[model samples]
Target: MKKNRFLIILTISVGLFLLSFSLSYQLITNKSEDNKIAKIENNKLENDDKNVEIIKEEEKVSPNTIIEQRILYKECGDLIVTNQTPSTDIINMTKEKYENYLTNKKPFLRVISFSSNKIVTWGEKEHLCNKHFIIGEEDGKIAVFKIGEDGERLLHKIFVDYPVELLMELDRDEIKKGIRVDSEEELSDVLENFIS
Candidate 1:
């Protein structure tokens, strides 16, 4: 009878010991989790404070920001990038009219994108057109030529055959000084006028 009573006491003591150990382990893990949460909130607050300082510095440096951009015009596998500070006229223009004003300045060009630090454009195309056409008489025919990016004259093709009469129709010096057209479409228009 005594042995059975001792066994019961041992079982009860073991059960109590296990329950206490489980409670202590749960409290330790919960405290660690709470510390991690506090650290995360502190880091977030620090980042927010840094962001506020950056905004304050920006306001002091340029209360009225001046925007500057580079214009990139592309056509016929050629690209031109130019930096510009917008004029008051351009600054006052509405978003809808902005592209129109740019196109009017270079009618051959059309805006492809208006992005940060750059405005991209693409224009009319012609084989070997580097944006400049030189019209002159070549081999007894009215020939078209392109001024290369490197300033070399590359013959494009002949337009129509003509005698000296065609040359006389132009400025006396134009025949010698070289005729320049801005685009491929303009080159065809000039030839059409001469043919008529």
Candidate 2:
């Protein structure tokens, strides 16, 4: 009887030990799988964030876009002028309309004289002639002038603040006729000597 009892207790103890070992092994494997899944989820979130940043960068406006939207102007000392019409009008102006505008408009005059003694002479001719369109502002206000056949009849007032730019467009014919200036000084000299 003693031998039988001892064998029965030993059998029960061994069975309990094996069951506990199997349960522990299963728990460890499940914890490891959970960790791997969490890591994958974190990586996916990081990738998503990077993708969003790239999209935002692409949507930002570029300098070239801003430049394209604004009219191109030429810069002289404290003055900006353009031969072209206002940006809005130019966009809608037909070639025939532009030619008519030019034919009816008076020529613009600009003068700059820098002497050896540092004396500077600057002026402009904004005669009304037939060109009544408001090309642009001298400063921020509309540049107003009267029709004049000579520089003396042109206005000498400063329309805007100093250091302004003017935007102008020349036709192919005008360019062929030597209507282009290499610099502001050159433009001023040409205007001072212009016959028309």
Candidate 3:
């Protein structure tokens, strides 16, 4: 009876030990698999972030076709002009009145000023020689005028025009090349090169 009882207890203990060992092994294997999956997910997310950054960089380098409109103003002495009139009276001005304004040169200092919502790409360099300048279309051509400080002398008259897209591209290229057009002559040359 003693031997049988001892054998029975030993069998039960061995069975319980085997069961606990198997369960512990399974739990460890499952935990290791979970860690591996978490690591893979983390790596995937990091790769995705890098891909997004590359995509954003590509977009920045690509040429965008969106056209941007800007309001430019030309100021001469006391007069300010824009492509669109500021008031009804200026809009209703007669041809004679317009002609007279253009023909009658004011004796006061002819300080030609320019204002625009668009960034001035060339103004700082031009400002070195001339106190004031005008950038606008004249006779269907883009023109720049450098006015003397005393308002008596027209220092420069530069006519430069190209397709708006081409002009923008040229400006971008110039920026990349670190090219600066300090004088009207240089501007005319640059425009001619781009146009041709």
lDDT leader = 1
lDDT of each: 0.62, 0.39, 0.45
Model 3 quality (TM-score): 0.28
Show the lowest summed lDDT stretch of 10 residues, model 1. 56-65
Ranking by lDDT: 1, 3, 2
Give one digit per residue, the lDDT tens place, for model 1 in 53-162: 44331111122223333223333355454445566566544434656886677565665655334444555434334668888666666667887744667888875555
lDDT (Cα, tens digit) per residue for candidate 2, span 1-196: 9999999999999999999999999999999999999999999999998888443321211222111111112221224333222334323333344334434652232112211222122234332222221122334322323323331223333334322233233422232232333444654554443222
Q: Which residue pairs collide, candidate 1?
A: none
Better of 1 and 3 by lDDT: 1
Using all chains and alpha carbons, the TM-scores for the candidates as numbered come to 0.33, 0.28, 0.28
Candidate closest to the true structure, highest TM-score: 1
The residue ranges of model 3 lying beyond 4 angstroms of the native Cα positions read: 54-196
